[model samples]
Target: MFTNDTPRQGLLGRFVAGLARTRQGLAGQIGRLFGANVPSAEDLEALEEALIAADFGPALAQQLMTPLHQRLSRRDLSNLDQVEAALKRGILDILSGVAPPPSTMDHQTRPQVLLFLGINGSGKTTTIGKLASRLITEGGRVVLAGADTFRAAAIEQLGLWGQRVGADVICHQAGADPSAVVFDAVQAACSRGASHLLIDTAGRLHTKRNLMEELKKIQRVVSRQMPDAPHERIMVLDATSGLNALVQARHFHEAVGLTGLILTKLDGTAKGGVVVAIADQLKLPITFVGLGEGVDDLQPFVPETFTDALFARS
Candidate 1:
């Protein structure tokens, strides 16, 4: 029901524009450091500090600085071009190494299931809506499963997205058992021959063991309905949360084995380097990035484009 007629010529441009804050905060410092002369030890120290402040985290910041330091010692990085190129290469290496595997769903898999998990305020709901829009535009039938029954507003939000995208939403009343909702939604998706089923789970912190157990129960129900159901368990992360996002990811990955990540609010945060941190530390592929509030702003993760955007001159 959604149309893919919009021009995509500006996707890269939008990606670049959305990263303005991050570039200004992180890359701008590097640019200033490399502007005039070969960087001194003091300059390298400053660069390391900048990287850390950008939320690359201490370990990754050091990992990135190591190669540059080696190049500096060997007198290989003499100019701004070499300096910028080296930094860019380092970032790309970290990101590409953990790139997510190709989607498991094919034409034969009538309903490829994706389960979304994250703490509240991580944009899980909005990510689902944008993903549904993308799937529908690609000529795929979608069924939204509002499994976040703990919150009535969560169900209403998903229903609105379903209506807007012309996808069916399977939901029970507020406070309904989430596992039951998932079971019913799985059955409905199979019966309706939907190509994709997106399940939105309750947004609870990883510290909440009871809620995590509920998530496992929902997974069990879905698996019972179809052995290979819930093909992807994705955790949505807020770009602004910095290292805390990594903590959330670690817990969720342990709880349900997260297959990928979706990072939202990139346009609003200067800590976009957290993406690199997440990839390097968690080894979780970032599947998509929410650049802005628009439905079309959710773009697939491309390491080259992202690194370029991050380092591109303002």
Candidate 2:
């Protein structure tokens, strides 16, 4: 419904296209009912099914449809415009509850520490670089600690990004203690008078006890280096991972009190609605979102801009 070559389309085109494909799985069943003057029980049932199948989850899909269903119950009920309006409003209402973005720090300490945590392939390391780049662009000196010493490639990747963004990165050899690397990074940041210290921890599995312990050790040492350090513990989640993402989030939040979330792969995922579900479920601020694969792709999560992208006219 959003293809008109209208200039207002802008990002809405890409947003709709991304979500529309996911909707295709249910389009056949719900397409005919949509924009119809009087939708049948089959139509409403199909609509609900579509939402659930899209991985909005059962509770969320029902909550999204509650208002629509309530209004559609009236016998005076109306045309396709009414149905479309109801559906749009219902989805928008649920999104309206989404919380705001993370606030910038006041840099109370010598070097403010922001720890990045997530499972393997959760995009934790890159998010550290992205954040560091942002801090640099804002005129804040940043020092990155390649604390994921278990993976040689992780260190190399972080170092590469640090150079690209013109930030200093501290690292040690593979098999080196991760905590030790964090200690060095914090010391370097403090010694150099850097404003921010972004630490990239090993992307360990939530099921791995040893890995979780290593993270705790890293945090303990970082705090000792600069009390009140690690001002924020950010968890990076893959938006495309669907329901599993929420489970991962719960584990991370349990492991380390997650101060906020950095949802990556949003531009490439139709399950972007999961952001709303996460927000409604955890209520943690979505600190950042990866819109594309660029140094500047990551942006502070803005609730209304995101909602506009999700349901804006394409």
- Candidate closest to the true structure, highest TM-score: 1
User: Which pairs of residues collide in candidate 1?
Assistant: none
Ten-residue region with minimum lDDT total, candidate 2: 1-10
RMSD of 2: 5.0
lDDT of 2 by residue, 193-267 (tens): 998888888876355688778888988998897778788888899888977888888887888888888888776
Residue 34's lDDT in candidate 1: 58
Candidate lDDT values, in order: 0.85, 0.74
Off by over 4 Å in 2: 1-34, 75-98, 101-107, 205-207
Query: Residues 1-314, candidate 1, lDDT per residue (tens digit)?
Result: 22323344465687788888888887667667757677776777788888888899998888888888888898887776776788889999999987654452343666988899999889998999999988988888899999888778989999999999888999999989988889988999999999899999898634589878988998999999889877889999999998899998998899889888999999999989899999999887788889998888888777878888887765
Estimate TM-scores for all models.
Answer: 0.94, 0.86
Query: Which pairs of residues have clashing backbones in candidate 2?
Result: none
What is the alpha-carbon lDDT for the whole of candidate 1?
0.85
